[model samples]
Target: DSMGDEHVWELLLPLPTTASTSMALSLLTFRLLLTSSSSSSSSEGYWSTDEFLPENRRRLRDRREKLERTLTESGIPYLPSDSGLFVWMDLREFLPPPPSPDESSSASSSAETESRESMERRERSLYLSLLNEHGLLFTPGLSMKNELPGFFRCVYSAASDGEFELGLERIGRCADAMRRSKEET
Candidate 1:
């Protein structure tokens, strides 16, 4: 139900219909109960639900907020997240313009294909530049099957606060450098 998938709902509508599905569902239930029993027990120390769940939620929320603030300050357009660990940021400003059409060529399909390939390379280059130059790992939109060319997924769920801030700073510097280079060209 949480998946909002009708096909899944239909599949599970007749419970115990198939042995494999029934066994899989039962195993999932067993795992959930086992995890609940363990985490609910205070004797588990660090794994106790009371100790870590709220703290982890707070940390994730804080990290997302921080990323939102950095994106705002940098003038980087981003899709406002309602409930997710990742933010979709638009970096189209950093992508080079599409290839100019050849005056003698009437083959628009080839030009379009070339443009797409070129854009993909540019997008990969941006992803690599951030990773290699600043140690920031952002998922390229192309890999995510995003039709838009200049979008990237920025995850905010893992890094510590200090490390996250450092990454943000590095992003700022990279953006500034890209802007400078673009202006020069």
Candidate 2:
């Protein structure tokens, strides 16, 4: 069941515009056939198999390959998959982890109880501020129960290549800003 789900997910993701368009056309044709008074049962055969299925598959495959090549050329870390459109990037190394309670206490002379919470609050604020500033977005980690803080998931789509590049540049700027902010504080 898990394998089937994975297969289905792979198929759904990274669909080329042509495949999507073809599927839409197929649906429309099916609807028309159903409504037409002269619609023959034999005509139903044409709608059964997608006429542009091959072209759609080829286009999607080409797009995936192009994306992979681009990421490789840019030296961006990415997960390679034959079926899926997305190349999941690993950003763990790029992002700094939240300061631990002990680390925060050592860094600040302020009261441990209040300072620890305050520091955490500051870190979360900084992270969100960076995201907002750079136009970068991410889903907070699932393990975060009651706002566990600091964990997040960023999803980069392949649809808008230009937007992705802009977002990455913004992220770089945000990282620099974070470094400067940390140095000042």
Candidate 3:
């Protein structure tokens, strides 16, 4: 009888074992939801270096410069990132276009057609090759404005003109290599 309406029953009857169990379960579920919500809300999603001590920041910056130099020597395009832990590479040109509705239907028919995993593999391979061949490495797939998983980020303390120049040189070399490869085939 008390179970018919929750609010009315609560007012009319003293708490029962079933009611207590239901209440406990609901509270537990609510608490879990709240905890997850708060955790996600607090995290801004991007890695920040402001929490580091000044000396540590300096070391990170120095290391970033050395890495940048190596990458430049090998020929990879990278821009000095202002967010302080990455160099941004524009990959808009390299990415394939969005499939049209007709194309999407055709793609769905072929299980081996382009896939997100395959795209990631290609990008990773290219990045690894650059690292191996030129000692230049980049954090691949990060956005300029937001942080996403598997995105490239650099850890550096300060930006310098010399670093910028070196980065450009490396990018030029990488671009040249890509062009040559395309021409050959």
Candidate 4:
């Protein structure tokens, strides 16, 4: 609050102490250690250059590419991200059309006679159907802050390599099943 826009004195915290400084330093050190060596104990493991460089970027890129391939092969659509622990897929095509953006518009009124309750039901059911039928747990895009509907986020790096592969397999199967069902309807 030193240069505060709100109440300067009211928002200010007490001046930092030596103890606080030491604690902050310790936390910083701990974070650096964790990020650099999450759980890889290969030979010559004394702060290798690969631990903090192009190697890590390359690996993340490879994983993303593999995930995109699996999604594509299963007839799922995705908007690929450059570098992240999670992948975002566009599941809109598999889902029924969303309620119109402008509720007051005549076009929206013509689109469906569904009430607000039905709209809520459809949104909730769509979220539940993917979870219950596919045995997958994803944070529905609409459920996340500022993340629009018609998307889902999957974190491939959260599990072991084998488990990640199995999860990908299940996702592919789910996508294929959804596509076939959509086509049949």
Q: How does each model score on TM-score?
A: 0.69, 0.40, 0.37, 0.60
Angstrom error of the Cα, residue 121, model 3: value is 1.3
- Can you write out model 3's per-residue Cα lDDT over 8-43, one digit (the tens) per residue? 222222211122224465446445633553355325
**Candidate 2 vs candidate 4, lDDT winner:** 4
TM-score of 2: 0.40
What is candidate 2's lDDT per residue for 117-166, written digit by digit as tens?
A: 55455545645665666566654432233243444433443335566557
**36-123, model 4: which lDDT tens digit per residue?**
4434422334233444345446655777788888988887778778876567777767666656647533344545464544444455
Number of the top lDDT candidate? 1
lDDT computed for candidate 3: 0.46
User: Which numbered prediction scores highest in TM-score against the true structure?
Assistant: 1
Q: Order of all candidates by TM-score, from best down to worst?
A: 1, 4, 2, 3
Task: Give Cα distance to truth, residue 11, candidate 3, Å.
Answer: 69
Worst 10 residues of 1 by lDDT: 11-20
Estimate the overall C-alpha local distance difference test score of candidate 2.
0.47
TM-score comparison, 2 vs 4, better candidate? 4
